[model samples]
Target: MNINIFRRKRKIIVPVLTEEKAKETLVRCQSCGNLIEYEDLRKNLKVCPYCGYHFRMTVSERINLIADSGTFSEIDTEIKAVDMLGFKDLLTYKERIKQTKKETGLDCAVITGKAKIGGFNAAVGVFAFEFIGGSLGSATGEKLTKLIEYAKKHKLPLIIVFSSGGERIHEGIYSLMQVAKIIQAVDSFKESGRLFMPVLTNPSYCGAAAIAMTGSIVIAEKGSLIGVSGPRITREVANKNIPGKLKQAESLLQNGFLDTVVDRHLLKTTIAQFLKHYNRRTI
Candidate 1:
């Protein structure tokens, strides 16, 4: 077959990006796709000032944003992840743990500590979602259980800043059992008349969602997703349409699922107020 094809050449237009406007001038908000200055974002605690999009923050940033300066004393820093079941997929579990630890500068996905929020002593745990999507493993469960016990023993309020996807499947069934261990520990802590607060961030699913639902004083960031399962799994397992509105913090707040929906900038003060009230009640 003989055919004549006429094609026009495509032009690649290179954007005339200036040095000031390259990376320093504007940082794009992931949710709203708005370019905002670094200083402006930092001033608002990494939240989108224009659209009020709550950005995911690092574990250190989370701690600093909530806890008072010079008051965070980390507990159980020695407890790191261990290889069980000799799990390997592309790399061994130990190798993945090592890589994640080296990069994130943390032993596990979760960090437990005693801190003074608003000058009221609290047992705080922050999950690092960057590390294995903040997966809950045996060590994570142990740390959380211990944190709860510590809170009960010391009569300190317990708060967990959660940002997790699900259980660490690398540990197999052991990882799946974490929620059970946590539930038991939480019940004990509650029996001791200790307050437990679970502050949820974006995409709090699986075990993290369980914690969010369990807390007496539950809080989530605005636009945060809170559910037992995310839409994908829920659609498959339940064989039904995923209700988009039901997953957001505002909807949950309206439905009385969440105690409050807080802005990242005001999170510190809101928690501080809660702590202050509890402290006064105890006194």
Candidate 2:
């Protein structure tokens, strides 16, 4: 008996689109109106190629972009805020903390870790702008000190990606203490002959600016606001108009407060070069 050969037909499948899927599929650059793939945006370090507009990056993303591949070892990841005064203004401090946690997925404003930059080991700390405006609270101070200590112990250079609105107002005076604490830590690290590099991102103001200036080498992002107070706040408090762009990174660099003002695209290369020069000198 002859048996007939049968062939199975391949089924064609097509993806169905929902409103949410369509919305999330792609986005245009706000500045250039150029279509950008979601994954491409992330891979490009959150910069729009069409217009050269830099997108805001979270602390983790900053760390990932700066650090060598698979080299970041995080420390003090569980440190969180505490409501010592039981502060309750417009919203309960506890509830505010919960909201920030949910929104940012970070326990505090800063994340401390160790990573390699250009094959040179360094201690890295990045401030989470999404977390309460990257406010300096007790936990932030503690983590910063811990990072410095780690750097000292490992004889590695310390790098901080600082972006903050200064101290956390809800935390009151406790937040102010962080300024002095971090300053002392940086000073000690310097006294030990180790390098402390502070990469100042946009809107670094108040206490954070003060601490950032203490770095052995301070670099600011192009067009970043580097000041104790923003223009709007200064104008409001002084009852007068402040000059536009008073606190821009370029102005700070001109005034010699910043060592360099670097473009977002060249930041990694600049940092790597600095680290290379530093390591060669130390060796």
| TM-scores of the models, in the order given | 0.87, 0.86
Model 1, span 96-208: residue lDDT tens: 99998877777788889899988888999999887887889889888888888888889999999998878887898999898999988998898878889899998788899
Q: Against the true structure, whose TM-score is highest? A: 1
lDDT of each: 0.82, 0.82
Worst 10 residues of 2 by lDDT: 10-19
Q: Judged by lDDT against the true structure, how good is candidate 1? A: 0.82
Error of 1 at 122 (Å): 0.8
Residue-level lDDT of model 2, residues 1-283, one tens digit each, is 3221122232312111122343446756655778787667666766776776666677877887888899999998778888998988557889899988876668899999989887888999999887887899999999999999889988999999988878888899999998999899888889999999999987799988999999989998877887888675676567677775778888988889989998888998889999999989999
Predicted structure 1: clash tally: 0
What lDDT score goes with residue 57 in model 1? 75
